[model samples]
Structure formats: structure tokens, C-alpha cells
Target chain A: MKQKRHETPLEAIDRMTDNSVVFVGGFGRAGVPERLVEAVCRRKLRGLTIVSNNAGSNVAGIASLLQEGCVGKIICSFPLAREAVAFRDLYDRNLVDLEVVPQGTLAERIRAGGAGLGGVLTPTGVGTDIAEGKPLIEIDGRAFLIERALRADFALIKAYKVDPLGNLIYRKAARNFNPIMAMAADWVIVEAAEEVGIGALDPEHIITPGVYVDAYCAVTRIDQMMEATP
Target chain B: MTANCGLSLDQMAWRVAQELQDSWVVNIGIGMPLLVPPHVRADRDVIFHSENGIIGMGPEIEGGDHVDPDLLSAGKRPVRLMPGGSFVHHADSFALARGGRLDAAILGAFQVAQNGDLANWKLPGARTGSIGGAMDIAVGARRVLILMSHTTREGEPKLVDRLAYPPTARGVVTKVFTELGVFAITEDGFVLEEIAPGVCADQVRAGSGAQVKTDGATLMVPPDPVSPREPVLSRA
Candidate 1:
């Protein structure tokens, strides 16, 4: 028989070493794994290189970590959406390091990370200073973008439910960045609302399979929330 | 006014073509400017570019039946391709923008100036701002045309003497359009080009917030009218 694998969201995060690269899933606080985010927040991990689609707005979530000095660098697109408070400050003071990724390339990079590819070829920011000094490759007489693969020590996302076996199901826009990050991390953690025994849920509904998951924890709701009004 | 939009939209489209015809390549920034493709005179040839890498783009698909996953417009919506259409590397598409291959670009503006200074990227009080390829297009296009309303929601003029917010491109704009009329940036400053059928030059100037003068010649309006199609953008 195979050894059983299980852990709480906090325990999953506890497994992370300080200053490690982390891949988080969320499109501006939409599907962020609350339990894991809280644990990382409380853990106060420093010098962390974080990757995500958009940093959460001011209240809590990704931007919250920036407030606590927990994040050292970020790779993302449109970091300063309407509700983004911390990012503007960090940008103004030159405190946080940011690498601008064009919107489409940002999505493809995450997908590339999940596909087990070392890097993806793209031409998004080539020639006119977008990808200058970065690696460039031509395939079939056509230029393609060559962006490096990104992996995280810990990956986090919200789930509607997860099997004890670690398969995950997400709800709505909540699916935004969760499933992709799951594929690109060494350890995948889910902070789900319900936990069920394996085989109790439909495999079709599962966004991420247990094959990539390392730990999970059940939680009521993520403490962080952000919007234009918030 | 075209079918779904206002008279302003049609006037702006006409002005854009007047300034940009014979241009080898162009990319209309997303949003209102995205609608310009259908309005452009089919007889005048121009190679259109979309940020999503589709060239020689045509009117959008109504039902999205063929929905090519491999190709979509910058909006991520399914779009039909023209006969000679081709897909380039997405990176190459952007290279065309940054590399200065375009002759003229017509973009929607949040604000413009008497001298055609532009601010279309960010709002100061808003937490986030969009610089999406606008910076690249504005700087690279040899002639930049701004399609915009005369005033903001606050009743302040969009055509200010100077830009109110940080500008994505500096001094690249060539013209402006409003419900009031059309104005072109000239060596001296904003010179009046036309006043809408019922509006006066002074009224257009007052709303524009910049010194305005005219060649004092009657303006010619293109007769081939455009009908705005219902927006294909689904409610997000």
C-alpha cells in the first residue's frame, strides 16, 4: 500500500523554507488560498520571490505581504489595478522589485510552468525594449519568446472542495490562477471549504489532481478581501 | 451617430481615416478605438494589427462557432481573419509595435492638449492604471490621433492645455475629435478643422480648454456613413 499523504494549509506552508520562491494563484484576491496566505503572512517569510497574475489590492492578500516586508520581488502583469494600494507605494519608494510581463505572456508563462516545459518561446516584448537583453530564439524562421520556467517552493489556491487524496475543485473566477500554480510548484497546498474522502467527488469537476498536491487544510473563508470599494 | 454609438464616434472614425490613409500598418488600441476597423473605408487599404497577433483582421464573428483557440484578438474574443491574413509570433506582433513599423495609430484618449500632448494610461487617484501597449503604440506611430470626448465625467475638458495625469506618450498626437467638432494640432497650436452641423467653433474651443483657431475654410465630411455594430464584448 502507498503511504498516506495529508497536512493542514499551515503545515503545508510550514514545510516551506524561508527565502524560497513561491507561486501563488489569484487574479486580484479572487481565488487566493486564504489559509495558506495567512500562514505565510504569519510566518513572515522574507526575501521571498513571488509570482502571480495580479497582486491583491490593499486590504489583505498579496499586497498585505508587501506591506509586511515579506515579499522581495514579484513577476506579474498590471500590478497596479484600481484597488492596489501597497504596490503604488512600493513603486513610488522604489522598495519592491517588479518585472513587467505583458498580459498574454504572463498567462502563457504559468501554463508553460504547469506543462513541465523548461521555458516557453514568445515574441511579446521583443526588439522595442520589452524583451531587450533577454534571451531570444528564432524557430522556423519565426521569432518566438524564450522566457525561463518558474517554480515555487510553495503554491497556494482556494478550492470549493478537495479529496483527502488531494484532488481540488474550484468555483467561478476563483479558478483564475489556482489550477495553473498547482502544476508549477514543488508543494501544492489547498485551503478548501470542505474535505471529503477520496472517490466521493466527481473527477470531472476536479481542477487539480492529487498527483501534484502535497498538503491541504480546511478553512471557513480567507481573511483577506479587496475590491475598488474595499 | 452610427447605429450603436453617437455622432461623435462616426466623426472620430472619419477624422482617423483622413489622417491615417495609405499608412502601411496600424494597431488601434483596445476599447473605442477597436471599433475603427469596421468604420474605415473598405476601399482605402491598410494592414491592421491586433495585440493578440492577428493581422488583416475583419469584422468580428457573431456566434463564435469556429472559435479558433490558436488565434484570438487582443480582447481574447474570437475574430475572423481576412483572406491574406497571417499569424505572427505574439512576440513579433509586439515587436511591430515597439519596432516602429506603423505609420499612424488612432487611440482613445483620457486627455489631450492644444499641442496634442496625450495622457491615456493612468488616473492618479485610482489604485491601478493600464499601460497596455499604449506606451509602445503612442511612441512608435508616426502620427497619433486621439479619439475622445470633449470633457471628463467631472465636466473638466479632456483637451487641456497640458496633460493632467502622467502621459504614456509625449507630444505624439496629431488630432482630436469631440461631439463639438474636429481639431488638428498645428505648428502654432490647436487649429479648428470643423464644427459639427449645429455647433460653433467657439463652443468647441471653450469645451476643448485650449486656444483654438481655424484656416477659416469650410470642412469636408466623408459621405459614406458607418453603422456601429452591437459590441461583441460580453459582460464581464
Candidate 2:
């Protein structure tokens, strides 16, 4: 299969629409596809349901939409990037609904989302308030708390490099949730920092297969949209 | 002793970790027990195991520090790995516990029976009440120390002659620590070991559903409290 690479960042986000469920690639401040987040913000898409591990680079990645009150809801393990006045106002007004998940459970749930599991189960939150109203199934009479599946319409992920065939390699923390969420999304768009022409990327270095990625967009300045605040 | 400030969870967690001897490979379940790493004796190498993976976990993280994306605790927050700390497959980490490599495990308990049975995994609220890794850790660890709030948020005592919530590990907890004091469960009954200075023996006994006893006639003196071997909040 040939990998189609988009030359411009705007070309990459033009595929997004209103009410799209997006999964961004970023664990705290690393490997965040700032280009995608900014492009999506420019799209002015509303009622967005973003699924991610965490949000960072305030007003740049996802934080902007959250600041602009564009996103309808956020389902994540944690979200703490937007503490600015605009973002806080929306959150306090009950405009945002946040679901905090146990980290392991959240990871496993994304893995489960990719694997087609009905619901991922663990004991992480069995006795705490995290277990409230979730179905509890027993294996050998040992209790496991259930955390349901999460999916998004589009998975906007960041890759350090990508082969022309769409085989991807992630750098540092970018590898955390991008690959897993890629498999879980209906449309997977990758914003690769570097585009290695076909047959250049080593087979062993490819973390994600070409089949999982729908499109690859070469990004020159991912930092443009991702600015770390003091 | 601190006059009920709500950090009792960490206070009880501290006592539980001190119960372990030197060179103890311990696993502290998420929640209150996570605080134990900060209370361990410096000379003793009290290794902390999170089910996600990694041992010899370091301290609590300052907000917005350099958080390691690789290291995570059972709570799912980024944690710093101490020197010599290594990551393994999470299954392998559980294998270490299930294979009985841990010397002690400090876990939060919802309820403790008169005989030290633990019911830390389930509550009466709703859909789920299943044990996760506690069953494996309980049977595997040499000693099980239960860390819990002595009373509920509503001020109801949780130590009882019988368990009210779902039991995760049966008869596995060796010691129970609450805001009031430490209780050791033997075949005879739950024994009172230490009382937070101002708290009365009658109050601890009255609050607990289990019969309480001390070491013979003499008032039980507590072992020396030591600072944790490593700060539990270091960035990994």
C-alpha cells in the first residue's frame, strides 16, 4: 500500500469537521502534534469529543478549543493544561465534563479499544469512587473493576518519522498513546515530523504499520502550535 | 496524634512500611499506601512496586516538573524510578508478586475482620466489587500490612469483628493501622499495639469491633519511627 503524504498542515486538518471525535497524540508535553491541534482550532469545529491521555501546551494543542469552548466534552485519564482564565470560566460554568481515569486502566482501556474488547477490567479502582456504577465481573471470584471502551472519529497522532508507505516511528514520549490510539480510531491521520521517502525507514524501526495509518502529513514546525508556558 | 487533619491516611501508611524489616521488597497498593515510600528508613532499602511495573520507586512529584512518560504508578501518575530501578512487562511485575518475591505489602483496607481478613477491594455502592492484584499480592508477599483510615469519611469505624465490604485477601493482613493506632491480628484476636499519644485505649477498643489486646500487661512500646529510604516524589 502506498502512503499518501500531505505537504501542508492545513491540508491535513481540512479533513476534520464539526462534531468530530478526535484523539490527539501527546502525553504531557512530548510528541504532541501541535500542527494538527492548531489546524483543527482554525477549522472552528464545535462539539468535539477529544479522547487523549492528557492535554498540554495550553491554547495550542486541544487547550485552545477548550479555551474557545469549542470542544463539547473531554474523556481522558487527566487534563490539566488549560488553567487560563478563559478555560477556567468554561469549566466552572459546567461547560466541560471531565472523566479522570486510573492511568493503568486508561492505558488498558485504549488498548482494549484497539483490541475490540467489550470493556477492560482491572482492580485499580475497585474499592474507590472510580468503581462507582461500573459493572464488576469476577474471574475465579477475584474482583476486577470495569472501565469501558473509548473511541474517536479521528486519531490525530504525531510520529517522529514516517516512511512513504505510512510506516511510522515515534520518538520519546510520543510513543506513549499514539500507536495504540491509531488502531482505535475510525480515521487515523498522522502528522510526521519527518518524511522518509518510501523504502528509507528501516522495517525494525517502524512502530506502526502502514495499514493503521490513513494519511501522513509532513510537519516542519510542530513547536509553532505547542508552546510551554511558565 | 496530630489532632485529625485528614493526613491520617499517610500517617497509617508510614507505620505500616516501618513494620517491614531491612531489605524488604514491598509493594504498596495505590491510594494511602503510596505515601509509605516517603516514610521508610533511609538505611533500609524499601523497594516500592507498582503493578504497572518498576521497583525501587522514588518520591512524590512536584506539579509540572519533568515527568517521566515511561514510569507510572498504580495511580497512573508519572513516577520517578530510583537508581537501579528498571521497567519490565507489567505481567512480569505481577509475576514477581504472584511468585512471592515481596517481603511485605502495604495495601489500603476497607474493612478488617477480627482475624485480620481484608476487604479492601470492594464497596457496597454499585456495579463492581472485584479484586485485582491484591489476591495475588496477598498470597505472595511474606507479610501483608493494611493501611486505612480508622474511620469512614462519615466517621464510621471500619475495623470490625467481620467484614462489611467484599473481601479481597482472606486472613492475609498481618497488621492494621488507623488514625488511632496499630493493631496486630493473631489467631487469638486483634491485638492493640500502638495508640496515637492522646487517644485512649478504651476509644480504640470501643471503635474497633474486634477484641483488642496488648503485649501482656505492659503498655506496648512502639518501634522507632524512621524517615523513608527515598523520597517518594522524585521525577522518574
Candidate 3:
């Protein structure tokens, strides 16, 4: 079995290149890969596209990337949080590109990318601005908008526990977007709270099976600002 | 509109909460809709769905020592999970809404047109706004209930004949609960289903941008507004 575990998060995230499309998993700070995001910020790579639920808030997480002028485009569902001044400033100044997708469609599109599907036809965005300029198809007397699959060069994700083989589980609502992102990216780097022994995690309870994970690091700072504080 | 003329915000939330049926899986949207779940009757067994992957979610966790930062609502407020609660990832969680598993979705709105068209995501000519999960919940839920004030703070009616703002979905809203009363989106138009105690049909009509039919509408006399911990039953 391959040893997926790495000595540190910075080393685990060593393969990310400049101008890469990255998937940062989280929903309003839950399940966010803070340490990996910090590592990417530390690397100061430029012109990256970030796909996530929220465009990072003003202070932490993906905001650090935007603060460093590293992002070129952002594809997300909501970018208008009160503290998301970082994204708003750059977007208003035309310094970055923005594509707002319906939250469900974003998830389905990523899932389609990982599952080897062509695209998704969803009713979530029909009759709205989201439907504008997108291909519309009528099926069974209902309209559905065509959303293309979204793939990334790398995915930064957080997990609760991982085994030597990289099998993973998440705590509470922190599982948002992490598992699917793990499959959608070419390389999946995980920052987990604990690294357990193989076969220690119950097979029935594991959320992301080890085969999808490329590299993993066990984080010592367990409670280090995982949530975007209000 | 006068300050004392309409139901309080909590009263409006209680009115909306009363409409939920037993065993219904309901998705509560952010903002004012967040106020509805807390008022839900404990006996109703209404499973609350948060877009960020919590099912059977409980109330917001007040500041405490043991608050797990990972456990949060879609609104990002720390919350607790009920005994039968379970968690799924983002895709599977939204599948519950888009796949028609939700019995109802209670949401906050900017405008609800007479024909049940909903405009909530963004304002007209705004540079940026958040769509979030409002669109999915609007089109996929079996029923959509809206909670908002009868009029904006500027006193402009939110229940309109046509939407000036961008719509989240068309012909999706089943009912709307506001400070003035409960308005059911019927085939005819907005029908005044329940009027607040101090408000009259003329006032409701004046407060609505669309025509409001008050025929056979009943008066809603709620009991004293209390903390959400206790059920605020209405007079039968």
C-alpha cells in the first residue's frame, strides 16, 4: 500500500503550480482547508482560479490568496458575505473574474466532472439570470439549464480523520464539498486532524475512500480558525 | 405602515411555523427564514434541512465552552444536531432538495409576484449579489413559503403585481407570511387568507402592490408573543 501521509501540509501541497485551477472545499468556513490555503499563500503562486462555495471572507482562508493578488478568477455560488470585502474589491476593480452559479448546480457540476459525465441539466437556474446565455433544453415539459462539469488541477480539503491508505471521515457539517472535490481534482491534498492506522477507521463510516486521495498531512493545530468568524 | 399596526417579527415567524405539517422535511433559507425553524412545534417532527449538509438540525448554539466550530448552519451560525440527525456532503445534501425530497422550503424574499414568481437573490441593477441555494429550493420543494415584511422599510410594497428585481423562480411560492397577514398565492392572485388583528382589508390592499382579495379571510389573533422555547398557539 502507498504511504499517502506527508510530514507537513506545506510538503503535501508541494506539487501545486502557478495558474492552476484549485478547488477549496468548504461552505461558509466549515470544512475549509485553512492550513493548505495558508501554504498556498506562502507559496505566492499567481493567476489561479478558485472554485468554492463562498469567495473567501476578508480576513482568512481563501482571502489570504486574494490578498496576495494570487487569484485571477473565482467561480462560486455566493460572493456577497458581509466580510467578503477582499473578493468584492477585486471584482469591482475588474482585477478578477467572477462566475456565480446556483449552489446546487455548483455541486452537481463538480460531481459530474469527477464521475465522468458530460454535463448536468438542472432546473435550479431556469427562468433566472443564471439561465442566461446557457443552453436550455426541454425535457418532459420542463426546462433545464445545461451546466458544464468543473474540474480543477488541485483540491485543498480538510478531513476529520485519515488512515495510512488515506481513507477519510469528516466531523459534523464540515463534510461539505470535501469528498466530491477530492474526486474532481487531478491531485487531492488533505489536511486532517488525525492520522490513524489502516483498518482503524470503520469501512462503513469512511466518507472518502483512500483511492481518491493523492497526499495527506495530519495537522497538529486542531482548532486553528476552521470557521470564518462572523 | 404604523409600528403598532402589524404583527411582530417573531409573531410573523410563529404564523409561518404554524403552517408546517407533521413529518414534513423543510429546508429553511437564510435570514428571516432562519427565524421560522426555531418556532416550529416540537410535536410536528419537521426535519430541518440546511443547504450546507445538516439534516434534522437544531437551534443555534448559544456561546458555550463546548461549541464545535465544525458544526454550523448554512448561515454559518454554530448549531446543534438533533438525535436522529445525519450529515451528507454538499452534492448529496442538495440532492435532497433538487430530487423532490423536501416537503416545503421557507425562504426570505425581496418580492413575491402575484403569480407566485419569486425575486430574492438580487436587486435590480446591483453589481453583485448571492444566489446561494435559493434557486434550488424554490424550484424543487413541493411548496415554497415566503417570510418578509408587507412593505420595505421605505414602505414600498413587497407583494407586487410584477417583479422589478430578478426572479429566483417562477410560479413557485404557495404562501407568504408577512407582518400584515398570511397571503396565499392562488390562481386568481394574492388572496388575503389571514388578516392581522389591528389591520383591516383596506390597509392590506393599500400595503400590497398587487390586488388583494379579502373575501372570507379570517382574523388571526395570536396568543401573547413569548420565547420560542414555548409554543405560541393561536386562538381556535
Candidate 4:
């Protein structure tokens, strides 16, 4: 049996290059890979495209990356926040590109990318500005907008627990976008709160199977990165 | 803040809640639609769903002391779990929506067209409006209910002949509950089904940009909570 490889958060993030599309998993503050996001900010790689649910708030997450001026574009559902000055400033200055997608459509697009499907037909954005320039098809007399599958070069995610074989489980709603993102990326690196034995996690409880995960690091100082952010 | 000639925010919520049936699975949108859960009658037994992956959600936790930060609704508000509450991943949560499992969805709107088109996610010159899951819930639920003030703060009517802002969905709004009255989207146009206690038909017509038809419409009375007639029934 092949063993799962483990690396530190810094070592894992060092593999990413400039101009890569990275998917960060979280809804608001939950399920954010704080340590990995900090590593990206500290590395200061530029021209990156990030896909997430929300622009990070004042706290340390993707907000740190935006503050560092590393991201070139953000594809998300909710990009506005009261304390997200970094994103707001860049957006106002036309320094960054923003593509806002509806939450359900975003999830379906990522899931379709992983499932090897071409795209998804959804009624979520029909007759809206979101449907502009997109192909509209009628299925069973109902109108649907064709949303292309969204795949990323790498996905950085946070999980509650992981086994040596890389099977994962998440804590409550913190699971948000992590599992789908894990499947829709070329490489997936997870920051786990706990690392357990190979057979410890129940098969049914495993949200992301070992096949989708490439590597994981047991995060000890997740809060240290947030604390370091001013 | 009370409107000039219509019901209060709480009153509008109560009116919207009256549209729900017992054992219905409902997804509530952000903004004023979030107010509907509090007004649902205890006998209705509605199960609240949040697209962020919570089902059978309870009321917002008052304080942060005992709140689980991770347990939040799609609106990012802290919420408690009902007895049989469950959670799913993002994909599955949307599947429940896209697959047509939701019985009804109550949403807030910027404008509702005469033909039942909905425009709520964006304003004219805002950088970017949050779409969230409004699009999915609007189309996926069996019925889409809207909750909003009758007019904008500038006193312009939100019920319009055509939407100026981007629409969330086409012909998805089945009913609209406003401070002034309840309007149903019929083949003819926006038909006034019920008027608030103090509001008249002329005020509803004047406040709406679209034509408000009062033919066969009757005054709607608020449900009395103190009057009990039958035993409480549970779907479980």
C-alpha cells in the first residue's frame, strides 16, 4: 500500500507559481485554510486568480492576500464585506477583476468540473445580467443558462480531521466549499485540525475520499497567522 | 421604521408567514425574508433550510457566548439547530435546491415586474451585488414569495412594468408581500389580493408602478393568535 505524503503548510504552498488559478474553500470565516493563506500572502506570488465564496473580512484569510496585492482576479459569490477594505480598494481602483456568481451555480460549476461533465444547465441566472453573454438553452420547455465547469490549478482547503490515507471529514458547516473544491482541482492540499490513523475515520463519514486529496498538514498554529495579521 | 401608509416590517413578515402550509420545507433569502421565520405559526411546523448547508434551522442565537461560530445560515447569521437538523456539503445543499426539494422560498426584492420577473441582487451603479443563492431558490422552490417594502426609500414604487435592474429570475415571483398589501402574480398582471387594515386600494395602486387590479379582491384580516380552535398537529 502506498502511504500518504505529508508536508508543512509552507512547503505545500511553495509549489504554487505565479498566474495560477487557486480555489480557497470557506464560507465567510469558516473552513478557511488560515495557515496556507498566510503562506500565500507571505510568499507574495502575483497574478493569481482566486475562487472563493466571499472576500475575506478584516481578519487574516484571503484578505491578507488581497492586502499584499498578489491576486489579479477574484471569482466568488459574495465579494462585498463591511471590513474588506483590501478587496474594496483594489476593486475601486480597477486593479483587480471580480466575477460574481450565484452561490448554487458556483457549487454546481465546481462539481461539474470534478465529475468530468462539460457544464451544467441551471435556471439560477436566467433573465438576469448573469445570463448576459452566456448560452441559454431550453430543456423540457424551461429555460436554463449553461454555466461552464470551473477547475483550478490547485485547491487549498481546511478540514477538521484527516487520516494517513488522506480521507477527510469536516466540522459542521465549516465543511462549506472544501469538499467540492478538493475534487475540482489538479492538486489539493488540506490543513487539518487533527490527523488520525488510516482506518480511524468511518467510510461513510468521509466527505472527501483519499483519491482526491494529494497532501495534508496537521495545523497547529492556525491562529498564529491570524494573530500576526494587523 | 414604520412606512407612511402600510404595515410595519413585522406585520409584513406575519402576512408572508400566513402563506406557508404545514410541513413545508422553506428556504428564506437574506434581508427582509429572514424575518419570516419568526412569524411562522407554531402549528405550521415549517422546516427552515439555508443554502449554506443547514436544514431545520432554529432562530438566531441572541448572544455569542454559547453560539457555535461555524453553525451559520447563508446570511452569515448565527443560528441554532432544531432537533432533527442536518447538514450537507455545498454541492448537496444546492442539489436539494436545484433538484426541487424545497417547497417554498421567501426572498427580498429590489423590484418585481408585472409578469413576475424578479430583480433583487444588484442596484444600478453598485460595484457588485451579492447574488448568493437567490437565483437558485427563486427558480428551484415550488413557489417563490417576496417580502419587501412597497416602495424604495425615495418613494418610487418597486412593482414595475419592467425591471431596470438585473433580474434574478424570470417569472419566478409567485406572490409578493409588502407593507401595504399582498399581491399575487396572475396572468393579467399584479393583482391585489389583500390590503392591510389601514391601507386602501387606491394607495396600493398609487404606490405600485405596475397596474394593481382590485377586481374580486377583498380586505385581508390578520390572523388572530389568541383564538384557538383545534389541537396542534405535527408532521413527524
**lDDT per residue (tens digit) for residues A1-230 in model 1:** 22223455657676777788888775545466656777888888888888876656766778878888888888776676667788778877878888766555665577677788887776444433356677888888956558776677778767767777888876533555577778878877777766788898888767688887777787654322211110
| lDDT (tens digit, per residue) of candidate 2 on B12-86 | 656665687777788876677777776676556667776545677666466464555434555546666677766
DockQ of candidate 4, scored on C-alphas against the true complex (2 decimals): 0.48
What are the per-model numbers of colliding residue pairs?
A: 9, 15, 0, 0
Tell me how large the interface RMSD of candidate 2 is.
8.4
Q: Can you rank all candidates by DockQ, best first?
A: 3, 4, 2, 1
Best by DockQ: 3
- The weakest ten consecutive residues by lDDT in model 3 chain B span B227-236
Q: Which should have the higher TM-score, number 3 or number 4? A: 3
What is each candidate's DockQ, to 2 decimals?
A: 0.07, 0.07, 0.59, 0.48
Interface RMSD of each: 11.9, 8.4, 4.2, 6.2
Show the colliding residue pairs in model 1. A80-B128, A81-B128, A121-A145, A122-A144, A122-A145, A123-B91, A124-B91, B1-B6, B1-B7
Summing lDDT over every window of 10 consecutive residues in candidate 2 chain B, give the lowest-scoring window: B217-226
User: Which structure among the candidates has the greatest lDDT?
Assistant: 3
Ranked candidates, highest lDDT first: 3, 4, 2, 1
lDDT of 3 by residue, B142-178 (tens): 9999988888888889999999999999899999998
CA lDDT, every model vs. true structure:
0.66, 0.67, 0.88, 0.84
